[model samples]
Structure formats: C-alpha cells, structure tokens
Target: MDPLNNMLTILDAEMGAPSRIEKTGSWAVRFDEYQQFRIGAVLRGDIWLRVDGGAPRRLSEGDCYLLGDGKPHVIGSDLTAPASDGDAETAETGGLETARSAAADPAAISSVVLTGSLGLDQATEPLLRSRIPGYVEMKSSSYRSQVARPILELLSRENAWEIPDADLMRLHLSRILLIQLVRTALRTADGCAAAPPDRLLTRMDERIRCALDLIHRQPSKRWTVANLAAAAHMSRSVFAARFRTAVGMPPLEYLEMWRIRSAAAVLQSTDRTVSSVAAQFGYSADSTFSRAFKRVTGRAPKQYRQLAA
Candidate 1:
C-alpha cells in the first residue's frame, strides 16, 4: 500500500467521525487551542481566517484548510468580527448528532461551510502534524475541482432533498470530501512546505520510498537506522542524512514517532494493557515505552488511554 495512504488510514481510525460546522456570510467563530487537528472546507462564499498572532488570509470558495494544530484561531468575514454572531442551530441524521448551521437569516442558509475535528492521537502527537504548519490551506484551484467539488455537491444535493439513504450518502460523501481535502493538502504549495508540488510522496527517490514502505508496513518490527539504510541500499550515515533532508527528521527519530503513533491507534481502538501495548510495538519494557511516550506525547501510555477513554 502507499505509505502516505497507510499513515492517513491510521489517523482516520483514531478520529472516527467529524463534528460538522456550517456558517454563512460575515459570520465568525473562535476555537480554543486544540490538542488534536481541525480541518475545514468552505463550500460557499469566503472566509477570513487568522491564527493567533498570525496575519489573516482570505479563503475563497472550494478551499480546504488545516485551521491549526493545537493553536487557537478565529474565522470570520474579517479578523475583527465578533467571535460568534450567535448560537448555531444543529441538526441530526443517521443517528449522528452533528451538523452545525449558523442561522443568521431565518429565511435561507446564506452559505455553507463544513468543518470537522480530527479527534485522534491527541496524546501521541502524530508525526505528520509536526512536519506540517500550524495553519496550512489547500485551495481547490490547485488541482482538478472535479475531485472534491462533485463529492461536496452531492452532499449538498442529498442534504437538501429527502431521498432514500440520504443521511448515509451524506455521511459517506463527507468522509470522502475530507480524504480528498487531505490528499490535496499534501500536494498544494500553500498547504505544507514539506509537501511542495514535487515533494511529499511525488518526488521520492526509489530508496526513500522503499524505506518508508517498510516502516509503514511493519512499524512493530525492530527497525534501526541501519536496517532502513540497508533497505534503501545506502550506508547508515548516508541514509540517515538523506532521510532527514527529505522527511525533516532522522530515520530513527521518525520511526519512534511512528511507533508511538501506532501504539496510540492500538490504545484507542482496543482494550490492551499498557504493557501489552508497549511490547507489541517492540518497546523492551512498559517503563521504557512510558518514558519515551512521555517525552514525545507529554503523557504516559496509561494516562493517555484513560483520558481517551
């Protein structure tokens, strides 16, 4: 499987669903510095967004943004707009109690903006999050509009009509929209520095691709810098340097981050004991894993599991 797809699948597993948000013209909302990731898609009109202490930017229609990574941000028609014009009217469907709509006009919904929280790996701090900026954006014009536009349009159509399995269709389409959003984010220049047009997974040399594949396929394996280097057919030193240059981290360092992430997925999805979880991922002892997890995630495995629970 593609390494990037492998990593994204893990993220979705942890953040099983989205908390939908919808708004319209000149509306604004403020979100606290979050521990997890927040993603938003503007379906209509435009949005003026500003991360804390960051300059504001205009997000036009058909834009997808990674609002922030554990940073507070404000979204509105302008930076100075009130945090919230008023409470939002929420609707439910398919037994999922989400769908946020800002009813500024009782007559009609002026605009539609959908936002979802990637509620996963809050404790472990997934590796991809660090490589990406606190606030990154992907505008649809960068790629074919057909990719996300159709999916979202289908959602809009299904939502406005009372048709068979409309709720189920919307739910599935929303998830697809989010996946396309992230996939496009990885390709857009404005989305991430590490993911320039020819960077990310597109321009990976064969060696680097092989190494990444190995790591993703079996993160539980006892993978050392030398092992990855051998897989990449490079000396340990050369492989380490190249991996760092391309991926923004030394090979083993990235591996540790991946291990912690894999452990986190297991912890959130299953009822395994902390020791068992650590051992399953090749950590020699629970204490060793706990210390390492703390250094990276700011919490022990047990504590992280409890909080997630």
Candidate 2:
C-alpha cells in the first residue's frame, strides 16, 4: 500500500467547523499563529496569501492550499491594506464578518473563501508534520479536473448552510477534501522532474517510502536497522542516514514510535491486557513497553486507555 495512504488511514484526524467569508474591494486580515494545520479554498475572485512574512502568493477561484507549519499568516484581497487581527474581528462579529466596500453595490462580492482547521490527534501528528512541508498549494486548473472539484462543490454547499445535516456533512467533506489536497500535492511534486530532493512529501524518495511501507505493514515485526536497510536495498549506514533526513528520525526510533502508537490504538479499542498488547508489538516486557509508551504518549498504557475511555 502507498505510504501516504497508510499515514492518512492511521491518523486520527478531525475537521473543525468551516466558515465562509465574502468580501468586496480592498481588505486584509492578519491571523496569528494557528499552531495546527489549516486548509482553505477560494470559491470566487482572487486572494493574496502570505505565511510568516513570505512572498505573497495569489490564489484564484478553485485554488486551495494547506498550511502545516504553525506560523502567523495574512490573507486578503489587498496585500498592502492595513491588516486587522482576525481574532479581534471575529470576536467583534462573533465570527468573520461579511466585508463590503463602502458604497459598493450589494451584488459586487469579489471574493469568497471557505476555510477550516484540520486537527490530528497527538499520537499521529508528528508522523505527518515531519514528512510534509509547511505549505502545499493546488492550482485551480489542476484540482478542478480531479476528484477534488466535486468535494469542493459539496464543501461550498456546507459553507452556504444550504444542506441538511450540515455539521455532519461538512466534517466528512472537509476530511475528504484535505486528503485530496495532499494527494494532489504529492502527485504534483512527483511529476515535477526538476523538483529538489529536499522537498520531502513532494519529491519523496521511493526507497524511503518503501521502508516506511514495510514498517507500517508489520509494526509487530522486530525490524532492525540492518534488515530494514537490506529490505530497502541500501547499505545500513546509507539507509539510516537517508531515512533520518527524509523522516526526521533514525530508523529504529521510528519503528519503536510506530509500534507504541499502534499499541495505543489497540488499548482504546480492545479488551486486551496491557502486557499482551505490549508483547504483541515486540515489547518483551511490560515495564520496557511502559517506559517507551510514556515517552511517546506521555501516559502509561493503562492510564492512556482510561483517559481515552
């Protein structure tokens, strides 16, 4: 199975309530650090989006982007306009207010944006944050031709509050849309022959992906550096270096983390004893597993299960 697909499958992801913003003429809003992933799509007109003081990027209708890095950013129709703090405006309006230019015609809405937060449970957040860049954008023409367009249409309906079961529908649609965005970003990166190696998810090295697949496929297996390297058809030293660079951790560390994380899922879903769960994931002793589990999850297995329950 594809490693990207596997990561999305195992991640405990949730979509926050989506909001729509309609604006006319020049306006800019500065949003403080989100510290979590954010996703947005332009429904109509144009937008200027800049993250952490980076160069401004224009997003036209049908375009969407994901922000994985926790940094302050700005989005507006006019980049030079004095930006008002988004939180302050939201508090004053109880949410993002519909903006219009003074004396502008009521029908002259120049921009409409659909936005929301993508939340990942603590156990799986690091796995993705390490692999994806701070930002990924999917152009209008590119995404509109793929599976994303239909989902975006559904999301637009949610934004309009025109559909039944609005909350439930929005949640599922947002999740699917986020997945499509990542998939498109990955494919776009993969197709770019001139893309650099440092772009992790975009130009993910096939060999490293193979190693990740092996780990996810069999978290219970006693995967050593030597064997994982051999499986990837690389020398042990080279494989270790490459995996660390691409994945942000040494091979064995990733294996242990994955094993513990898998065990945490079982703890919440099943009735197995802690010791049995530990052994099943290659932890020969309960104490050994408990320490590792606490290191990754900040709670003992039993305590974690209790909290989750």
Candidate 3:
C-alpha cells in the first residue's frame, strides 16, 4: 500500500469507530477532559462550541469538529447558560436522543449535536497519532472538509430514522467520515501543501521509520532502546535523539505509552482480568504493569476498568 494509505490504515486502527455515539440537544459537559477523541457534526440547528476557555464559536448545520487529542470543549445552544442535565429528548430530524434542559421554555434548545467519541485514548501509536493533531475545527465550506461535509450529511440522514439497516450504515459511514476528516485536517498542517500528509510515514528518516514500525507492529515484544537503535542502524545516542526529533518521544517511552494505550482499550472494551491483560502485553507481574500503566494513564488497571465500565 502507498504511504498515505498505510498511515491512514494505522490511524484507522488507532481511532476505530466512534464509541458510544449519540445525538444530544443543548449539550454542555462542564468538566471537559479531552480524554476521548471526539468528532461532532451539527446534524440540526446551530450550537456554540468553546474550548480551553476560548471564546464561544458557532457551529451551524453541517459543520464538523474533530478533537484527536481530546482537548476539552463545551457545546450548547447558549454558552452562557448554566450546565443542565435532563432526560434525552427525541430529535425531530434524527430518531436520535437529545438532552433537553428542564426549564420553563421548552423550546430553549434548538440544536441537535451528533457526538461521536473517537477512542484515541485507547491507542497511543506514536507514528500517526502524535503527528496529526489533537484539536481541529473545519467548516463544510473549508478546503479541508469538502468531502467531510457530504459524509456528515449521510450520517445525519442515517441517524434520522430507526430502520434496522440504518444502524450498520451509520456505524460504517461514521468510521469512513472520521478517517477522511482526519486526512483532510492533516493536510492543513505545516509543510503539508508541499507533500502528502501521509508521507510522514513513507518519507520519514529511514532509521526512525524502522524503529516506529517495530514498536507499533509488535507492542507485545519486550523491546529496549538498544533494540530500537539497532533496528534503526544508529548509535544509541544518535538513535535516541533522532527518534525524539522525528517521532516526538524516546524509543522506550513510546513503547510503554503504546502498551498502556492498548491496555486501556482492552480494559474498556473487554472483561479481561488485570493480570491477564498485563501478561498479554509482556508484563511479567501484574504489579509491574500496574505501576507502568498508572504512571502513563493516571489510574490503576482495575480502577481504569471500573471507569471504562
């Protein structure tokens, strides 16, 4: 496969589908933690989105926002309104459930936000994940999201009904649109105009590419800095520095990060025991892996599992 395709494929694996996809009305999650990759499309009406204390920005119908790094953001009908939580209200356009504020004015919220949780938190594959972006907002009219707009429309239409086939179609189309959206967003990055964004995978420093591939393709392997350097055909010092410059982290650190991220996905999506999950990732003792996991993820394996659950 071509380099761009290869990178896209890797990113596809990293992000997967939008977990816990939902369409909500007048939404605002006050304590925003950008822990999960989020792709949101304004399926109906208009909403205001603000991130990291920035000014509120308007997202009209057909706009999509991607948060790969999970930068916290708030979206609602009115940004200044107090955070409200109530039973989900049925959407007029889509059969999706939307949260309605319990207030005297029933028509207070007119926006239906289709939110998809992109689980990048579960996959820290350094090569593609770190290189792209953590936060990006593109309008349907922008050069970046031209194709994304149509895909979003299809998703909006698919979500509008309760057909049995609509579920599968919505799931698959959401995944496709996400990959396409990420690709377009990366193209707007620096030096992207001169080269295909995926060239980062194919056109990387030869040695660094070798190391990155080794780590991502074999996260189960017990790898060391020495092994990665040898794979890159560089001296230890040169390899470490070059790897940092190219991939944004030391070789060994990347391995641990990838392992922990994999562990998170497994823990969140499965009923696997901590010991078994740790062992699967090459940790000899559950405690050793627990410390490593906690160091990287801020929660113990069991605790993280509970949170995921």
Candidate 4:
C-alpha cells in the first residue's frame, strides 16, 4: 500500500468540499458545518476571543489560529468583554466605533480573519478530541507567511463593502488558506507526522483509506463487505476487522453515512425531488431512503431539504 497515495486521496476528498463565508461589519469570516477542524485567520486589527470562563485571547493582524474541536467560543473586538445585563447598546456602540475608527486608520491598512473547525468526522472525533490541544497557533513564516498575507488582504477588502464577487472571492481565498493550514498541521517540526502519533497510518491504514475513497466516489453504487474487501485487496474477515479498527466503523456503516452525506448534497443544492435523490443513491424506495437519511441526520429528507434550503 502506498502511504503517500492514501494520504493524498484523503486530503483531496477533504479539500473538495465547499466552505462557507459571512461578513459582519469589519470582519469577514469563513467556516464549514463539518466542524472537524476549526481555523480562523485574523487579517486586520485584533479579535478578542471569549471562551466560557477563560480570559479573552487577543488575535492580532496577520495571525492564524486553529481550534481542533468545534468547541463553543465567541470572537469579536475588545468590546466583547464581559458586560452588564443592559449594556447591549454600550457594547454595540463601542464595537462599531472601534471598528469604524480602525478602518479609517490609513495605517490600519487591511486585515483578514479566518477561522475553521477541524474534525475527522464522527468516527475519529474521540481520537482527535483526546489528542489535540484546545487550540494551536502557527506563526506564519516564509512561504506560508507569504501565502497567508494575500488572503488577509482579500478578507479585509471584502469587508469594506458589497463589492462585486466579494463573497465569492473571500470563499475561494478561505479555501486556499484552509488547505495550507491542514498541510502545515500534518507535518511536524522534525518532518515526522504531526497528526497524533497513535493516529498515524500503518500498512493496513492505507487500504482503509482506499476503501473509503471508493465509497465516497461512488456512494450510489451497491457495496457489500465482500466487494469492498476485494477492492482493498484483503480477505473479507481481515478487511472488515482492520477497517473497523482503522476507520472506527464497519465498512458498510461508513458507506451508509457517505450515502446520506451524498444525498444531502443533492437535496441541499439541487431541486431534485426526494424520490429522485433516493433512487440516485440506489434506494429501492423513497421510504428506505428517508429512513436511512433520518437515521443518519435525524431529519427526514423533506424536512432536511426545507431547513437546508
């Protein structure tokens, strides 16, 4: 098994998904619902992050911060500090005034803030949660430093106003930053693996990745234990056992999850009927699809589509 090829396949699938972006006053932020890994790039000014009981951490210009779990955290300017019950107007006015004044500063230039929540899906959540710290900061330098600078500029530019394709541009730039962040996070100081040592892949790990790719690339195809084992070049017993150990679930269970995820994409992005999506994913009947979808997502296809829409 080629370890490099397997790693590349995993990364390629992770990077192919779309990321989301929003503009709030002076801040332009991008995030994904997947929430496996969380990242935030601060382009201009400073952001004060208020975690439940911890003191606020200040994120300055050109800084990138990552939060491994999608832990509940609040980020804003200094005005985000603890306030009285009726100090809403005071905080709002203060934040707006500060952001406005900062934008007016010719020296302020432009800054970008990028944040992402990183996780390896539900299967790997426990491993990541136990291994990674609450947050890790990478001081951008050399090539990474150069690459991040422009992303910050773009974010700052978009936050100025509703420019043409501004949101689209921010989303694209955020995606690039995300890829770079993940790459950096995967390689260690000594060039060894940066992902948890215990989580590092073995020979069998490569095969599991291959099997996962097969499921992701063709979720609509009928997949059985025997067929998947053959695809991974392993015997049924060995493949099933090793796959569960490496990927944290039985092969068929992972396939069902991927199928629901695929159907979700269609339901959210396309006008296709639920029955059409059900058939697209090889379900014999819409009821089966709905039951499976509800099992995975906790909402029926129709309700999920409506809420997503």
Ranking by lDDT: 2, 1, 3, 4
* Count of backbone collisions within predicted model 3: 5
Pairwise lDDT winner, candidates 1 and 3: 1
| Ranking 1 against 2 by TM-score, winner | 2
Weakest 10 consecutive residues, lDDT, candidate 4? 12-21
Off by over 4 Å in 3: 10-31, 85-95, 103-109, 120-125, 142-171, 189-195, 199-207, 213-233, 237-309
- Lowest-sum lDDT 10-residue window in model 2: 91-100
Clashing pairs in 2: none
Query: lDDT per model, in order?
Result: 0.64, 0.73, 0.63, 0.56
Query: For every candidate structure, what is the RMSD over all alpha carbons to the true structure, in angstroms?
Result: 8.8, 6.0, 9.0, 9.2
* Top candidate by TM-score: 2
How well does each candidate superpose onto the true structure, as a TM-score? 0.52, 0.65, 0.55, 0.50
Instruction: Provide the lDDT at 170 for model 2.
Output: 61
Candidate 1: tens digits of C-alpha lDDT, residues 8-93:
65543222233344555556777676666676667667778787888888888887676546777777765665675222322242
- How do the residues 30-82 of candidate 2 rate in per-residue lDDT, one tens digit apiece? 77888678877787899999998589999888887889888888999998998
Candidate 3 lDDT score relative to the true structure: 0.63
lDDT of 4 by residue, 111-138 (tens): 3344323334343343234434556555
Q: Kindly report which residue pairs in candidate 1 clash with one another.
A: none
| Total colliding residue pairs, candidate 4 | 19
